[model samples]
Target: MPVELKTPPSDDWVPSMDDLPFHRLGGEEEVKALANAFYDAMDADEPALARLHELDAQGRVNAGTRERFGLFLIGWLGGPQHYMERHGHPRLRMRHGHLPVDTGMRDAWLRCMRKALDARGISGGLRRFLDERFANVADFLRNTEG
Candidate 1:
């Protein structure tokens, strides 16, 4: 199960987006869990986005892609440098260069991620922060205009 998020107390103690997200997310395990949930949501709700990904024999997210993404998210959310340590700098656009990622694809990807974040009950400041960040990255990934 994904970790449950609770609102911080009245006293202001918001960690920087760099630190808070990973810590609030309960580290790698929760991130991995979110990754799994994210893909599961994609497979079930976003057929177009799911089709863009390579799936396994059972039509689930391929193990390698999931794990790599889990690691990527860790580094992205300020958890660890696992993805960079293992795969070096993440040339995200180049890595996804083969795919024709347009605005529609970007929006679909964001929609699936939004579903995953909501499904995990992620809310409050953490959720808002992530929604903004993910939106930016998703938009940036668009390789074609329109």
Candidate 2:
């Protein structure tokens, strides 16, 4: 679900997944762990999805891919803007446009993410919120019909 702002402006308004999650989700380190876990799970369990990414000599997603994603997640969770500073806007769909994302790929990606979140012990409302957000983005990135 894209962020919704119901606003004339609440006294303490913040973007969804903004500042609150950054702090509540244990800041930079935990977020980076989540990114790492995501790629690791993809590497282990989703060969088709993993092959779509740049791989290393060991056949895992390359370090650069991991680093960039870590940076992206940091900013996405509102910890820092390093990803934006280094890469400009996320432009997620545009960046992913070259990939032939379809239902299968999208589902594979979500499974990896779910594994990552579960491994991290992410639960409760936070887990639900993240699940919805991830699902929305994954679906949005789909470029072809099944």
Candidate 3:
């Protein structure tokens, strides 16, 4: 697709995610817990997927890496730009370029996030929105054949 500019709608029109208030509803603390639970789910339920991560001596995702991603999620969900302030642009696909993100990896990653979302009681409209967004990112990350 090509870039196209158009007149903006009236001020009464609300931006999509802005209207959802996902981060506000989850809060920073809640998002952190969700991030940790996501990694925990990767550890417990998707060992093969977990192999793509850097684990700590305790056999869990590296603490700093986990924290960095948590920071990324916070900003990603319309919160403060902590991750960008400290680490610069996410460049998600570029960052994952070295990983052969095949269909299985993409699905596994989404599965972990979905489980994490479920664990946190994210449902209804918010859940649907988040799931679709996450799935899009996951699919976009794919770099290899099945």
Candidate 4:
């Protein structure tokens, strides 16, 4: 069975986003790579999920969508706040509210992200932290019943 995505308890202390090995993971380039890989994985394997994003003539995620996601990932991973400065706060739920984000869609997203992180060779404690955190967000984004 697939692991479920849920937030961890607040009682335990966890590193802030900026303290999550962003520099150790090679900062901007690596984070951007993760974002690209994420979209690539979704495009290649998660058709249902990919359909929700803006695509180009070739049926690939558009440059603007990819670029925006990359910037969001960069800031989310604690590298830089360029995404915020350029686009304002990431109103994640508000931004995604237009879509019917059911459990299956959420799972598909997590699968793509897992593939991206694995492709990037993200492991150890960092991997665990990322896995848990990503799950939390993915779960939170679900807006429909399965």
Instruction: Give me the displacement of residue 52 in model 3, in angstroms.
Output: 1.4
Write the number of the candidate with greater lDDT, choosing between 1 and 2. Answer: 2
Give the residue spans of candidate 4 off by over 4 A. Answer: 1-19
Q: Which lDDT tens digits does candidate 3 get at residues 35-55?
A: 898999999999988878899
Candidate 2, 22-133: lDDT as tens digits: 6767988899889999999999999988898899999999989999999998888778899999999999999999998999999999999999999999776677768888
Among these predicted structures, which one has the highest TM-score?
A: 1
Give me the runs in candidate 2 sitting further than 4 Å from their true place.
1-19
By descending lDDT, how would the candidates be arranged?
A: 2, 4, 1, 3
Q: Taking the tens digit of each residue's C-alpha lDDT, what string does model 4 give over 27-68?
A: 888888888999999999998788888899999888899889
Error of 3 at 126 (Å): 0.3
User: CA lDDT, every prediction?
Assistant: 0.85, 0.87, 0.83, 0.86
| RMSD vs true structure, all candidates | 5.7, 8.4, 9.7, 9.4
User: Which candidate, 2 or 4, would have the higher lDDT against the true structure?
Assistant: 2
Best by lDDT: 2
Q: How does candidate 1 fare on TM-score? A: 0.87
TM-score preference between candidates 1 and 3, better one: 1
Candidate 2 lands at a TM-score of 0.86
